[model samples]
Target: MKILYKKGIAAVCRIAALYFMAFLIGACPVAAEEEQKTPGIHTWADLQEAINESGPGELITLTGNLTALSSDSGLMIPAGKHLTLDLNGYVLDRNLDSWGEFGSVIQVNAGAVLTVRDSSVSGGTITGGYHNNGGGILNRGTLILESGRITGNTVLHTGGGISNDGTAILLGGSITGNEALLNGGGVCNKPKGHMTICADVVSGNQAPEYDDVFNQGTLTLQEAEPEEFHFEDMTVVRSYMEELAILPFLVMLAILLYVVWIDSYLSRERKRIMLWIVLLVLSLILQNYTEYRMSMQVG
Candidate 1:
């Protein structure tokens, strides 16, 4: 009886061990897949492939400049997907007249959300079609530009740089040197579309009617405050502000590292570090407050 019981216990232990191993093996692939699923885009084909595979809220970064070889339809955002394309200081050139069809350099389909930043869209020409609009970008969905350039685009009808039939928000960028044969050389907001330009420059665009912008729908322009940096001017102030914006975060990180390193040291050193941090933070706060007050008084 004892021999039989020992055999049964050994068999049970082996089965349990097998089950545990299987469970671990099954779990490893999932974690590994997530870690390995980094998407990179260097060419137009790679960008298209990544866009097709990505779902909503996925961010795709451009690894290099991509110039369209053929006039095939530009990159299309899948419907219902909110994707962010980080241009990473790259350029998307449509290589105008490569194809005999009408297409924008970047098309945001209906019900899709696309945010483009830190990139440039140029050398796109849209013509000879029913929808000859938005030579640089045709947005039927929601489009947002944080900082980029839309220039040197041509359209036969309207929106030499951008055409919107949905919603577009320009936070900071420049739309210049685009030409439209008819109207809205910089941007065209259709009847169903809405555009909000907050601190963007729309200038030097050529159109028969509205040289800079044409709005048939809702258009709101929020000019920057006098003290704020005007991105269009590209002045010394803008450059200074851009450079200074990262200093506060860097200082905070340094302070954090100092605190961590001093945790094992004497109480006096800890107190001194704490005092320095407090003083630095307080100075920053006071400086910001003073600037705000001065701006208000000037206004």
Candidate 2:
């Protein structure tokens, strides 16, 4: 057990720490430019300069724990041909619409792939907080979130955790406490994008669990099916037909009794009363619907 720990985990942390130092020394300048990248710039302008000068496929490593409290972010990885913002357990900038101001912690374009490892992305809410569509990661191309945590990110739409406009393969990690205005409170796959949720835990998310498929790709759910079935537990959240027999009818009955008793004395407003009655009756008819549901009283 000890041997595996050192080889798999301990070694990775050590390498990250070592490389982080090297990253701050301007050792990796993308080779395409004369400008050298530093570890701790302590300002948003310097961080922006590093991003502007960064080249495709360049590795910007954090040597030390650089905090971007001011306007400047710890690192600004914008949309380019291809690049990777290697975070060695360092914190990114914390603010509003940071992606718009400084761009995402790292943005990927179409057909591009952004890979993140052993890191934490906080400061964003479920609705456009830390990330946009591809919330924690706004990807028009592709994204690989491996062995990390994307929490405190919020989106007004799908993928409160991650909105994948393209293909997204979830190799490892946990995506919780994210909110989506629409589907996939945890993750949203739009367009031709695909998401592989394997060997991970997706719980404690807000918003409706809609089709993880935002893109027309196949929505593959690779989890164990529960024995006790429920309407909400399934794909559907509401049952109109069930409400007709139970809740809707009961509610309609109460409304009719109230209107007839109170408005009976006001004969001059007969037309108005009739209008309300017709509207309520129409609502009852339209509200009725049926679906294959299991009894909640089952053992």
Say which candidate scores most in TM-score.
1
- Candidate 1 lDDT for residue 267: 65
**Predictions: Cα RMSD each:** 15.2, 29.6
In candidate 1, stretches whose alpha carbon ends up further than 4 angstroms from where it belongs are 1-35, 97-100, 119-131, 225-299
After TM-score superposition, the amount by which residue 20's alpha carbon in candidate 2 deviates from its true location, in angstroms, is 33
Error of 2 at 192 (Å): 2.0
Score each candidate by Cα lDDT: 0.68, 0.49
Model 1 Cα displacement at 60 (Å)? 1.0
Model 2 residue runs over 4 Å out of place are: 1-48, 63-80, 97-106, 119-132, 210-216, 219-299
Q: Which ten residues in a row have the lowest lDDT in candidate 2?
A: 290-299
The residue-by-residue lDDT of candidate 2 on 1-299, one tens digit each, is: 87676457644643453354333323211222222223444444555565567565544444334434445432334455344444545444344443444323444567565655543453211123454454555666766655456665556567766676666666555677766667777777776777655554355777765533343564555453221211121101222433334554445445544544454233656536555654554444333311112211010
What TM-score, computed on C-alpha atoms, does each candidate reach? 0.60, 0.48
